[model samples]
Target: MKVKCKSKSAFVQPIGCMMLSIISGMGISPLVLAVPRQVSLHSPEQSAQRQPQKIAQASGTDTPQRSQLIQQANALYSQGDFKGAEENLRQFTKKFPEDAFGHFQLGNVLFQQKKSEEAISAYREAIRLKPKYALAYNASGMVYASQSRWEEAITEYKKALEINPNYGEALTNFALAMWQTNKKDEALSSLEKALNIFKTQNRGEKVNQVERILKEIKTADEPGVS
Candidate 1:
């Protein structure tokens, strides 16, 4: 998950590079292109576990048909068929506009295609549908981050953290945006918090990765280190 720091402008490495391993275990395929890692999408298994209840609540009836549609989209996404996934998700959202997950999935697919603006719109739609959608906020922040919109990214990440303080992914992303904005101390603090969360979650690999980044930051901050 570790990538050598290339330049100040590239603070966050490709999302795929950082999260590929984790996503693989969750039955999701990692993006092959080298785009800055933005947001983590729910794995197919996670989506399946949660979607039924969410669909029932939002649609007032969770039909087998709706579940099948979602599964089809998820299958396309897992197979790296972004176009198919997008089409299916678009249909799903149009039919169930209140389903935040559908919008979120659409955003993820658009992002994978490098349609930043469209992706942001989709993420925003998801958030509008579900104001407390922390993952959508995190995903939006990542798009901003990729565009080097550090301040906006920070704001979005903060909103996500407000909704879910222990959101490790958001905390990690927040730290990266903070560092890019030259808030070195704040970035270090956030990374420490993220590290602790990962450790508590028993994500040993992530803990190690964050520790490496933290060490690099501290070392670079030392006098004459550069």
Candidate 2:
């Protein structure tokens, strides 16, 4: 959210981890293995902005046709064809307007293309369709954070945590928004919680990143540290 005391690069994640780790609930399968495999699924909160693409896997009740469409979209998304994925998801949403996952994927594609407003709209629709959709709420916060809308981002992250208290990505991002708002102590507290979540999940990469941020935050608070 906001920064100070240091260069702020010590723990900055690539594009906010976009962690999409909350991506867990969506049904990601091996069909879209196009993403450069990073780490195996550990747990949520690992990150939201820095996460790799996670397309939805079909549910047991899903029609094969629908699953195929989602698979195709995932492939496009993994391949970095945001527009192509966008078009595919648009088609999917049009056909299944009530499907929260469809709108959710559409929102992800929009976010990648830098269409922040549109992405928010998609996420909102997903939430509307599935009020308990924590991932949609988290993704919405990411869009707000991307635009430096800290207050809004924090609100959405709070909503996500309410739905899923263990959401690590939301916790990390909520920390960023807190720091931006000058709630330094609250920010530190949030990051500490997030770090613990990653540690419990055995996500080494996320644990390392959160540790780096925690150290920097502590250093910044030291007497004479500029």
Candidate 3:
């Protein structure tokens, strides 16, 4: 995505304005409400090192046991049993501390539990275990963004993008950070690029979200009568 942003603190525009306006123009529900607070919904990318957690291809007798544990953990996660997932991931990591995937899964669980600092640390460990793990960098960037550390977030996102330029999640998230930091032009370019990429990729609800924001920005840019 090619969301460009400007580096100025000029009044950052609200994205929902345009979205609501567009919906109104379409003769849909004429609801009037304050804009919702923006939150990053994209989960950080999965670390390549941790990719084996769900599907371990290692040649070992313990593989089956490890896989079964991961499956159970996933089931728990899907069932909103975050505590159970956390326990499972913790035990798995203890047994396979050297496994980058284990660290990554633990980080994911910690993040879900709102343990931002711990999650970041776990993601860092995953990164250390596998320097080329693009997902770790992406996940770290997401944590940094949550902390409002735009520069750090940008750095992590860039690292992920470097590993894979087509990392759409990283691209869009980086754009959001840029927008938050008053990089309007850059943000727009990045958002546009993200929109284009998602049009072809099965990005699910993200496509609608980006489009909504883009529309709001466009409306916010319109010259309103004083």
Candidate 4:
């Protein structure tokens, strides 16, 4: 996709972007809280700040009016209406700033339009309103990672993991960041943890991506003329 953000920030690391492509290919899945004894290395926060709102559809009983607007914004987004989506989201926020999910979806649409700065701002607002929002942290991590801000991206991903230890994307991205930082062993370890988590989650595409990177890294590390 063509990213057209207001900021002129360049990509942080090719590896991170590659990982993002892998995750994107798999689709964004809503995270579910893990039961105790999942044997996960990381642990997610239960309530960082905000409560997720119910996503009422256009035909939903209550908030039919708001639902109509959300549907309109989504349609505009689907039609490549970045500006329109922005407007709709802004209006939506004005009407319901407490709606963390609304801000998050708006941020997603902004990111899709390549409005990195705007997307970041929207995501920050989402995080502010919902501190426990692991997904918001994940989204923010992507924005930072795309800008090659490896440290910031890592921080965001870590925060996401802290909120939900089973957040596969955060784990995978964190591992990718370590790889980009040249921490080969650490990267492999992180990826291994992620792969283990995916085994039960059925995130096959993501597993394949991580495995691909691991193979590439191993091949490069073979004893040879260096």
Candidate 5:
């Protein structure tokens, strides 16, 4: 699949986009939080900042309208109506600036539209609002990677990993960025972690992908290879 946002370099990393799935270690099946495919609404402040596990749980007790805005925005985003998603999300963030998820989704929409700087700003705002927001940091790192800004990308990915050590996406992205900077051992270590995460989660596709990456990396660095 053509990436939602392609990198400037020919060295495209597999599975580069952040998977906005049910967060692991939450004891919830990753199947539970399928945004865009089904609708779930909750006050971002109530659910997000308090519990990463309950990130997608709905109280239905607060911010119904705000939650609706996010639902509609996510729908628009899935339909490739990035402008419409942006409009709804802008309204959402304007009203509930503390909602890190809103800002992060808005950043995703902007990033899809190739508005890198605006996306970065939104990601930064999400990070500021929730310092432990691994998803925002990962998304920001992906944007940097797309621009071939390896150092910046590595920094953001490292921060994300520090916050959420089980975040497989960030680990893989971090490993790729590390490879770009010739940190061979660090890259290999991060990729191994990612592979283990995928294996433990039974995400066979991701495991296969990571294994491919590991092979490629090892091959490239072999004694006689370029």
Candidate 6:
């Protein structure tokens, strides 16, 4: 997803136009948290930061009333008012059951509330309403990753990538899942691709983060190194 950074305002601003991407194919699910060799899987802060922007962008075609409701929910979420956001989103979704973005935004609020199962359900509904909702797939994958369901996470990431190959956030997350599943080589390869994409997109922060991960993976892979 692309987030354009904005100046500090009274309400929480949506993710700036900066793009966030994820990672690919893997197997072997573990119940325990699978610490990646390099880079963490997902960041709640980052996810929260991006929600408003994504919701705004995706809601362009929504009715003004629905749009306002979504905006309110986004603001509430940004302000850390999870319950308020949840209530607003629930109302919004109830009013617009077919609105994919509404479901997606609801998922974001649920995720912030640490309601993983509910978040997944919301994301799934979003995807079901919009079969090609790559971000929904990516978000659902994140939930799976948090549960240490690496295989499931990878599957979700791959679906996101299939919809948009240059989805940087999905690529990065996919790489992380691969690494967690003990597929270091594959993870490094995916990271390299993600790094290149981020660089091309002029996403300096993501490029730097991916570079650091690449360095860590390479260092670990070096002969005689742990």
Q: What are the Cα lDDT values of the candidates?
A: 0.67, 0.67, 0.62, 0.65, 0.67, 0.66
Q: How far is candidate 5 from the true structure (C-alpha RMSD, Å)?
A: 6.8
Model 3 segments more than 4 A misplaced? 1-56, 59-62, 202-204, 223-226
Per-prediction backbone clash count: 1, 16, 26, 14, 0, 24
lDDT of 1 by residue, 1-94 (tens): 1122334444543333333233222111122211112223343322322542454456664466667777788678778888998898889888
* Model 4 lDDT at residue 131: 80
Q: Per-residue CA lDDT of candidate 2, range 49-161, in tens?
A: 21323323333325667767777887888888989999999998887777777788788888777898998999899888778777788888877876767789889999989
Candidate order by decreasing TM-score: 1, 2, 5, 4, 3, 6
RMSD of each: 6.8, 7.1, 10.2, 7.5, 6.8, 13.0
lDDT measured at residue 178 in model 5 versus the true structure, 0 to 100? 82
Best candidate according to TM-score: 1
Q: Looking at candidate 4, what is the lDDT of residue 61?
A: 26
Residue range 89-201, candidate 6, lDDT tens digits? 89988988877777877887777667889989998998888787777888889878766577999999999889878777777888877876778889888989988877776
Quote model 1's TM-score. 0.76
Tens-place lDDT per residue, model 4, 1-226, is 3322233233322343344566543323332211122224322222222135432222242275666666677677667777887798789888877766678878887777767788889889988876877888887887776666778988998898888887767777787677667777887887788777776666566577768866766665567612
In angstroms, the error of model 6 at 5 is 29
**Model 4, clash count?**
14
Alpha-carbon runs more than 4 Å astray in model 5: 1-62, 222-226
C-alpha positional error of residue 147 in candidate 4 after TM-score superposition, expressed in Å: 0.7
Q: Between the candidate structures 4 and 6, which one is better when assessed by TM-score?
A: 4
lDDT of 5 by residue, 67-181 (tens): 6886788678668788998999899889877676678778877877889899999989988877888777877887787677889988898897788788777788788778767
Candidate 5: residue pairs that collide: none
